[model samples]
Target: MYYADAAADNSVTAYDLSSGSRTVLCNMHVQELTLYQEKLYFTCTDGEKRTIYRMNLDGSDLESLASCEDLWYMTIYKDVIYYVNYENDQYAILSMKLDGTESRILRKYNASDLCIAEDKIFFAERDTRYLYSMNLDGSDVQQLNSTYSRCINYMNGQLYYYGSEENGRNVYSCDLNGNVTGKYTSGAKFLMLMEEELYYYDWDDVLHILPLNKKSEEENTSHGTNIVSYKQEDVLKPVRSYLASNWAGYTLDEGNITKQGNTWIILLSESGGSRQYQLIIDLTTGKITILCTTEDILPVSVYLYDTAPSVSPSAAQLSEEELNSIADTWYEQNYGPGGAWCFEYHDYDGNGTYEAFAVCGPVMGDGYDIDPYNILEAILYISSTGEITVIEKDVRDTDFCVENEIEKEYYIEYDGKGYYVPHFRSGGILWQPMYGVKDNKPYDTGISGHISLDNDGDLLYTPNSGIFMCPECNNHVEHKHILAYDETSGELKSAVKYPSGEIVN
Candidate 1:
């Protein structure tokens, strides 16, 4: 037997009739509660979120079973607790084990007033305004009766319910097979059967006791005193802790931290090497698994540094066709005709010789350049089986003119080997230069240059400040403020803001 009390002092308590003792189930702001197997289950609404808790009959072992931003009604059956989750924008029936494991949605919509019968479940749905029943496994579904009800219970060979439709609220009893026997006079909102007495709460906020068979006035009053009393303000605190310890790590590079089930899995790259280590921590058992040292593992060097490598987004997995397409496009953009002549030191040929290819074509431009042409460069790889590689080359102009001088030239120079060059042309004139070995290697030292372009197609030499352009309008605008472009039919817009509190468009 169970009852809820919210005294004038705002304390809430739930009483167990067998022990004739009351326990403070939830100390917080609880709006609803139910009892099963001597454990008190209740819903507490804290701010915008609601959490369901379960505790021992003595209010000792309290634990939060499930939580969500919006949870309405709850009922317990077997080893699972089912509740109505309202935040999903649909009526969803969710269930979780008594141990707070495997919480998942049971069904969606067509759900109201849920009750667990002997091996069967009953509920009222809005669409049909009928009472329905189904096996505990959610199969063999069938409608029991047509009515608008909120609370339902199945005891012995009878079904008891209370609901409101056009005529306020009333209590009704029916057989297990959906045959309504009669309606009781009491206007009860919830009903329960205990010791052959119909225990229910009336609309007057007072508890009522009705016998299965008509009883005398004295018997009715005597049965009412047997119902345990409790104060609603008595809050119950659970026995278990909720928060987890903070995670500590040396670096975040190549690190993967994820939660699986009740365990946290962490895969981290070892310091100063490509090797990685794995750690698994179980929250329930308080166990940790660490792979520190293992056989058949090679020892790598490590170094301490003030700064660590910044991790970029992991590369997406691509199929063979996708990889081939991407490689072909990249090759064309970097080595095709009118493209940049940059050489990538990959094993393009099966030959053991790590040869160099002077690619001449139009490649994709990286820096600020509108329709930028391709440049040239040399390539070298560490070995056929090695991962590291190098690129080297130099760029030189055909003419010795001052303006033609390659100033601000960007060349892909190796940290160890050669350098590459950039190729630019105009008209039918050809400006190809001959290569020769000098100083034990190929080198260039005439009119080599670099160039930087602004966001606009205009060229800029030694610009004092970094310029940022609006991505949408392509306008060289300030940072943060919106700018409208008169060109492009007023379709162009940019954001520009000065270091001061001024905005310009």
Candidate 2:
């Protein structure tokens, strides 16, 4: 598991579950440690500026992406960076290309707890604290719920958030359209789901667990899985003995302990020295294993993938008909009949050869609504030798639309290469997939890219003047509001278009 240690030297560390080994990737004040495409993206300080940096998983190639004074809640959605920026005590959500170029504000609201899923951005307005969602372009904004909510998260087709109700704080569930589904575990916050169970911290900061499959929140589960806490003696006895025998000269200071399944991971440091060591203890058998001594094992540099797959410059090309046949044959051989399938081809990796985006599942009935059928979508990588492979599979139809809609591309420079990344439209929702080639195989990186589109289905970019005027309203009495940024505060402001076709703030 990869975690940021804010309290200890402000470092980012990775712990191996099986070996109980720890590797401190970087020793810097870090926040939002997101690992994408074998690279680690995090927010840290560059002097007084809050900056986002990208580095290898092993702490190499540390490059700064962007820096600002009032930036927080940095997250990557489909390779596009979404973050909250505050200026003049006003909050505005902005997005930027992964390379830190093409920065634009999507919307201006006092927002917090920003999350993105299913081609929509979810957030909580700071003043009302209500849940709201909007299209990737910041248009068609909709309120998801009225109750004050925070800690918003998207999971498994539902939005889970901490809702403040009249009675008490409860973890609530709602659909993407703002309809309430269920409420579970009252008086709890920081909701998280793992292994088909819900884990939360209560008012007293005590951790609790509830099985998701249980009929109600009242159902009970085994204490071993629910509240897995160990007594101090269970940890200190073995730790004290190991420390005294190994580092008798140093005095014990403090230790940070975390648990995973049946094992306990403890990091112990000295009082006045820089010595630090890790202890992995099996709670089941009470056997303690020393992971490393400060002087013993430092992390070795390792890349996420030793070799990334590249397209052959002279690869054989396929006609559209030939590509379809290959995808159909693979689908039949794997799924074995009954389901229908189709393919959309694009050069996802910016390679000369076009990769296939395949969608296969139970045939859909007329007129929308896919919840009735099991859908599976995949990205197919075909070699020059006509060998077919499924690079990424089981993508939900709701994500990358499976419909026959017009395709658009967002052109941006990445890794010094210009790519017209394909964006697909389904049911009026548009999304793009982030692709990575690892070990000579291509796969969806699970990072999505969002692009703003005008009503005419063209890519919408920030105007050169940083001001927007409604193109449709000309000499009309209806007042149309357009977005503009304040010159002094850099905050998003609204301008009204008048009947005379003149716009004024």
Candidate 3:
């Protein structure tokens, strides 16, 4: 069993129920627990910091993920972890990949106990108690109902929730469209909705299992757990034919299609080591577009099987001269003729080989461009073995380009081995390297590019103050104390302000 004993100790512990042994995986105070594919991800607090951290099953190799003020109510589905976080001062629904990439605000409202089903995210608001859902990519959100439900769970194909209706609190079942199907039972001090049984304990602490239908307990054990095998169903031959006819010579995995507005997004990949494809199709126009196919593998002292040469081994490793030759060629191609470029020299992956980095573009072109021509871009890491891994993203995003300036505004933090080498903590950039505190100065993130310290000079993780046009209010919103980073301790720290124009430790 994996859980957090926040009352006893602010720690997440994994227990071997059979052996009756437990190990504390982390020291942070957890609000939730999730175990997926031998990895544990949870939201926790260290002082004022509200952040997410991921670790291996054996309680080793822990890494910090995304952080925000008022970060709470988190859950994961597929590769994305959804949570309620502050976006422009308003607590809103947001999501990021397990590695803390692709962070986006799904909707500008506080939601809790999120459950994903039928290709959509479902949650309820705490204030008004309205149930809502949206597409996986934070699009096409809709209010399902106004039922004041909590501890919401989805089983089979229906939604089960606890709420009050005429005579008091009860467990009610609702369809995907949010219509009441049936009331299961009442009195839920604790509720667990499984595939075969609904278990709950009352104020007396007596656990009761209410069987929904006839099923063996063995089958019930396998239900609603992580790592379900993707049982391949028969696909329409025409759909397979369309894929084979279009991609031609590439074997496609099972295609899952979901609609956002009028565009249908089909997410699958070629059976290659480079997990690099986000394919999309439009049902209304029958148009197909290859949206994103950027390279993903980091060439280092480590080379994946197919990308490696069987004979020469690392013998044919490109010399710095040869790598510079390739970098020069790419630079001239991107900037057009006689553009002198110098790169930061380091093994960004820390794999004993230098990656010739350059801020070159037209690398990823956005389809939803403002002018469909070109956009300012960022640096690309050229490996010693001639593979280029994108430092920021593997694909083009207009909105991301607007917010993050990859070439300059962002800084790199390594895994504590090398000075300039970058590290990817959980496959995303290790640290969004904070503006560190300068020598005896009030550091403003936007101005000095250094983090501000409290009077104690302890590291802090806070969002730099800025303004962005709010989609909800149509007015600019001020970004508040985001999340702070403690570089010395390599921990996520929250900022506490004092009346004397100071921050706290």
Prediction-by-prediction clash tally:
48, 3, 10
Give the top-scoring candidate (TM-score).
2
Task: Give the per-residue lDDT of model 3 (tens digit) for 72-115.
Answer: 66778787888887545666888888898878877776777677
TM-score-wise, the better of 2 and 3 is: 2
Instruction: Compose the digit string of candidate 2's lDDT tens values, residues 272-321.
Output: 67777665554322345554576756332111111111322123366556
Q: Write one digit per residue (lDDT tens) for candidate 1, span 1-505.
A: 4445556222347555556566664466565667777777788876788988777766677888788878876877887787777775676777788877888766667576777767677777756547887776667778878866667776666778875633335567777667886554335666777777676665544444555543543333222211111011110000001101122332332245574423345564445665455554432222334443433242221110101112211112223333333334433543453322333342223232232323433333464134334333322222221211222323322331111233423333321222333343433233332122222223343322232334432222211122444463365544443322235442223334454645344
Candidate 3 stretches with Cα past 4 Å from truth are 6-10, 86-89, 165-167, 201-207, 215-505
Candidate 3, after superposition: displacement of residue 379 in Å?
Answer: 70
What ordering of candidates by lDDT runs from best to worst?
Answer: 2, 3, 1
TM-score per prediction, in order, is 0.38, 0.44, 0.40
Question: Following a full C-alpha superposition, what root-mean-square deviation does model 2 have from the true structure?
Answer: 23.7
Candidate of highest lDDT? 2
Q: Write down the RMSD of all candidates, one decimal each.
A: 30.0, 23.7, 25.1
